[model samples]
Target: MMQATTAVRGRTERAGGKRAEWTGGLSRRSFPAGFVFGTAASAYQVEGMALKDGRGPNICDAFVKIPGEIANNATADVTVDEYHRYKEDVNIMKSMGFDAYRFSISAGTGKVNWKGVAYYNRFINYMVKIGITPYANLYHYDLPVALEVQYGGLLNRKVVEAFADYADFCFKTFGDRVKNWFSFNEPRVVAALGYDDGRFAPGRCTKCKAGNSATEPYIVAHHLILSHAAAVKRYRQKYQHTQKGRIGILLDFVWYEGLTNSTADQAAAQRSRDFHIGWFLHPIIYGEYPKTLQVIVKERLPKFTPDEVHMDMLQSVIPQLKIQNMICKLVVFLIVRIMNFLIPLASPGAADERNGVLIGNRANSDWLYIVPWGLYKAVTYVKEKYGNPTMFLSENGMDDPGNVTITQGVHDTTRVAYYRSYITKLKEAIDDGANCIGYFAWSLLDNFEWKLGYTSRFGLVYVDFRTLRRYPKMSAHWFRDVVTSKN
Candidate 1:
């Protein structure tokens, strides 16, 4: 267990006579020695030149073509132009005193994109040169269009082999420089949003033109778990010996709170959690799906073969388990909010408010709520429920409306408070015996947010969409001060 000093309040006055109040006393010293502090962004979300530099199209490229699929019918063809401006981004991170930068390796299907590979080579080399450690994620919702066209993507077991090949390529190629690797980012989101709700790339659902909502989500999830295990196994066997790198999977969890303290509502909340995170984490850690899921989903859930069961059991001993827990909101009646993934029996009742009270202040995104203590609950829950595995608060931040001016965007006091509060809860969780090792803010720069596109801004540095210039917001400054503070 680790202990840190209690956070104290302080205020800073901004240029326009606005006051930004935060628990400014919380500094890097609040964490254990060697703990990591950094910012995180996905390749599809931040990398521009989606089709340039020999880059092949991804499922998102094809999905954004449908009318009104993304906000403003927008595409990530040139988001922040990270493909061209990674050096500038890394400089910003270094300037802010970040110890690491978590970015994804955006590989396309079919042939190897040498230009894309060269670009990441330069990117990783520059990060190393600038003293910024690179944490590379292998997948982040952007499956190759070829794989989807070939065999239904994650729906078919074939994807497991393809993904393992891709992961092996990444490990053999970039694992030398990137010390930390995550096999997948939010696999649950991939399975649920893509198959269950039809809201994301390769969209398919019960009512959509293609896909079986009930069965496909489970099948996709099962394959994803297998894919992660295969990747880990390959890394451990081939790369881990010589490259000396660490690998794990990233999971997204929304801390679910019952609308009421009644036994039924509490049970409903538990069900939401089991369906949400337990779907993946349980299989990886315990070699099977949660009993709640097995009972509820019944035969719809795929059974792991004996060999696959042994593979899952092997994964349980992984050193690091990166969890991306954000959106500390209240849920009711086990809405699960995973669309058709849950049958009608689960009931739909996800609300940030109950009996005329909000869970906390709502953010610009429909799902994000500013319930800070929910972070503590989430981390503590993972620590207690999941055997206290080594964890990282991989992604946690809120967004402001994207339609603001550069001046308005840079003056992001709300974002400052959001980080201050949420990070404080994270410290409390750590202090209370959660073996969390690091924290990464959701994003370093605003780029093409999926589904919502540019309508939501979740970045510490504000980027002018037209000019592609970067300006660190108030939150960034706060982080620099805290992270570099000698106190």
Candidate 2:
């Protein structure tokens, strides 16, 4: 107890401060010229018109309807109401000196939501008008509910066609203005959580009435990769010549470090990474899943057909297109079995703390622990392992508990420390020759946080859920200063 108390106090002294120690020496000028700074968000999390504005029901819409599925039986049906207040949100982003805004397009096909289309068009135009570059992502775990009900959603090959069509439509409509495109964000999470554990939307698992945890996650991941490749092929063959935009997929990666220097622990950490990021990236970059996965899963893992191999191989032909693997957050893991595979435990398994000392500081989220050095290790690992493809530090931020009062929320000194330390390590990675070009914070406002509902606040700006008002937090001001600094 004494040791734990001492550790907590030591961390508070280092991290809890009026200004984070790392911020004093860091500024916009500290990074290489042309580095992008922005905030990212998905449509389902922030856009509140789930049933209105001509939007169709997504898998989340259906999943949240189930009793006891989400926190407090909450739904995003009218969560933050960004659907009605985007102009205000975008203006807030502009005022923060952000150079780009990475937002997702959640348009559903089959009847076409023209009103939804018009809303996004206006949103994108206003950002462009105000000198904020737009980085658009096609899907972020919000699969059309109809697709799931009709043919098993991402598990079936049909989803590849559906997703390709959706990507094509987005390119045709918004490609001219949106130069940066991502086909899907964190498909790994979609597969592992939604299929493996039945934790996320379209929930399925072995124990559930539907889903085979062992096989479905692999099938969903295979289909997602095909969908990404198909979209890239379409953009390259049809749109790139005229539209002149770059396209990629977003992956969420957590840096897994061994508990000790023992050989078993080291191998366990590497295997965890292989199963996590490598499940998606290995096929995209090298045309197959990692060898570790191949040997371990053997017969259970789905085989890629020759045609599918060709589709996967297509991404490697385009050198300009890069992977936008978001360093969403990092974790320290001990070798553990999960979902019939030997991978890093998704939930907090291997304690973040060893010997009564926490790894860094714990964030409000159960899964997130603030370990800035983990960011450096994650980026450096991508460089060393994956041929150092051009990358983006896509989504990185800590969250506050949702119940904090606005006055308490705005004084976010800990979040400011989180950003300063994380970005400082990111610069260290860049200096170490990681081909990273951009960094996007996890979010711009406190909106619906998926299964956690509105209980976890990961935004730099505070949203008063009562009035749906926006108030910039200290972290937001810190970002503005860092971004606009001439020194």
Candidate 3:
């Protein structure tokens, strides 16, 4: 466990003679020896050149053009131009004493266009040359427009093969030096917001339009799980001997607080848990879908033929029903009941376990959140349920308005507070026996924030989209101190 220190307090005097006292929470002691500190950025979010260097168009490129898709009518066409300025980005990371740097590949869906291959090669090589471990992610919500045009992205099983091929390309190309690999970034957001909520790219599908009546998202998730497993299998069989690396999936979760201690609210919170976090984590760690998902799929979701199943499953007996049209309904109900009995228990005490953390978005926006303590709870939950493998923060940060300006610099005190509170919880999680190996801040610079475009800022360093100048915010300096002091 990292030691704790006194919170730092300071005062700032503005040019207008207004004075403000800044008091931060307890400063964490230096991170345990060899603890990793890093920053993250995604393709499409930070890598501009949406149409340059033979880069094929991704869904984001098209999604942003739709009227009212992005908040500020901004596109990532020239976002920091990381495609051309990766060396500079590496310099920024090095200057901040970052030990690891993670970035997402923008290969449209599964096709690895030469331009993406070259761009990622440059970025990974630059990180290697600078002595920073490069942790690369296969997908970060930038599905290829071609795939969506052909088969509605994850809704089609062909995407699983395509994504596996893309992962193979990445492992073959960069696996020599870049060993740490993430299959996807916050797939829950993709499942809920994109397919179920209809707020994100590949906008509202039939499932969300039908509200809970449609089961496309679960089916899509089925495909995604197969894709991830295929990628992991490929990495293990082919790349592990040479790279000697590990592969894992990245997921986002929040701590659920029952509205009250009543059994009904507790049950509701438990359902939320199985629906949200367990949806993704269960399959990857336990080799099966969450029970709640199985129930929902069987009871409320639409069904596909045997051809629709992404992976092979054990054959089950189906009894003939007496009613003519009720056959499908009866079959589904039986399947749901069978699943309720057959789905493996998550753990002995998972349902009753509560980490005493409250998760809520800091800002009212869908992207921003203030669930600092949830970080700890998530780690502990994973530890208890999945057997604590060497884990990383994967994603953590708050979003701010990108249009703000400051003379002294980009003073994001709110972001600083967010990081401080989250880090403190992270420290507590580590002390509680979660094998948290590292931390990765969500983003490196302000860029196109998917559907929100440049409306939200989540970067430790600020990027001037007009001038393409990178300026470190107050959080950047604070992070530098944290890294330098090994906290």
Candidate 4:
């Protein structure tokens, strides 16, 4: 969890203040030249043409239909209508002086929705025409519903191949113009919220069946990793020379700290890191899961065949007792086993390191703590452990309750502070030799926030779902200054 300071809270409290007044004193520091600063949105979250443009049905399209699945019975049927209004949206980006526009695309195996391809091509062209580099994400939780129905979405290995095919299509279609590519956005959310908690689309499992073989989040994550790797391999082999772009995975991670200095709390904090960020990151960087995770999965997850182990070593390598190691290893293993039974909290944190706390609490709320320091630590950890591959702050923002109203304009001072604190930390990381190249705020505007739906708003711009109006919040001005000032 990212810390909400008085500055941030004060901004949120003045949700109706004049945008200029609120943004007047915010100073922006100069960032490295060509350092990208942009806002992001996804197809399912903002685009309303769910069925148009020959767009195949996505998991989100189907999942929202399930009773009690979405809040206020709201579906992203008309979201911000970005599909039809992308040109206008690009104008908005250009007017805001945005150098890059990051958006997600809808693509699946043989189910290549050519209409979607055409739509994205036009969108890409518009961004290029407007002089904004387009950063396209292949998937952002909007898995094609057809794939989910035929195969269990990310749980099945077949989905990995399908996603690769989709990536190949994207690379071939838009690679000439678009350079930056994200294989998946916040995949851990897909595995944990969609597969394990069943709170989001394709809601299948819940806490009651928590840790069940059928509900293994790690399995879903395993396939997602394979899918990401396959896309990267495809891009490197086929598109790199012609496209002149780089490929990387975007992970949502935060800083975690022990609630106290007790050994039990420290172990719990480490476990939180292992389960949240390490689950997806280890494979991408280390080519495997953390050793701690392997032990937990072995104890709690179902068994797999030798062939499965060979093919999917990333997720299937649950630790076995036969391996001989130091006494410390055994002690750590026992401690984790005990913690698993005693503590049931795990969540990702904000991208910006504020205090030194982990953020999300998909399971239990008490265990979630905001540790801004952890953001710095997490970057250092990735740099040290993953050999410092090109990295960026993929997703980072403050979540606010939506009922709060802005009489004048959307204040969102909390979000502004969140941005400042995180960006400040990000600068420190870059100064420390972390090769971070870009920063994409978690969202451009508030749209469907998965299970939280219209309840949690993390957007710099406010979206009035009823009227489909887009209003830039106070944070938007803050971010605009940051971008214009190159801070």
TM-score of each: 0.91, 0.91, 0.80, 0.79
Q: In model 1, which regions exceed 4 Å deviation?
A: 1-23, 311-348
lDDT string for model 1 (114-222, tens) is 9888989999999999999998889988888888888788889998889889999999899889878888888888888898888887889888989888788899989
Q: What global local distance difference test value does model 3 have?
A: 0.64
Q: Model 3, range 1-487, lDDT digits (tens) per residue?
A: 0011111212222321321122133332535667778888888787778777777887768778887778767788887888888888888888777888878877754334676677677788878888889988888888888888897778888888888888998899888888788888777767666766576766655543433315656767677767776776677668876777767677766555565577766666666667766776665545556677677566543333453233332011101111111011000000000011111122112222235432344442453456665566667766786566456776677777766763323666677777777788788888888777788886788777776677677787777778888877777766765666512
* Candidate 2 residue pairs that clash: none
Q: What does candidate 4's lDDT look like per residue over 1-487, in tens digits?
A: 0122224435543774654344443333435656777777788888887766577787788878877767777788777888887887777676566678778887655656677777888899989988988988888888877777786677787986788788998899899998888788888777877777676656656554333324467678778877776776677668877777766666766445555567875677677767777777765545556777777666554343454445433333222101211000000000011121123323333232214432432111122233345467777766776566566665665666666664323756556665666667767877898767667776777777766678767677676767766776767656665566521
Error of 4 at 180 (Å): 0.8
Once fitted onto the true fold, the runs of candidate 2 whose alpha carbons sit more than 4 angstroms away are 1-22, 311-349
Candidate 3: lDDT of 240?
A: 73
Give the per-residue lDDT of model 2 (tens digit) for 1-487.
Answer: 1222233334443664533342556777888899899998888888888877688998999889989989898999988888888888888888788999899998585977789889989999999998999999898889987887788788889988888888999999998899888888888889988988899988998877688888888888888888888888788778888887788788878777777777776777788889888888887777778898899888777777776676444435434344332222221121122111244324424556665667776788877888888888888888898778777877888889999998788777788778888888889999999888888997899989888888999998888999998888777877876888777
Local lDDT at 41 for model 4 = 79
**Model 2 error, position 147 (Å):** 0.9
* Least accurate 10 contiguous residues by lDDT in model 4: 326-335
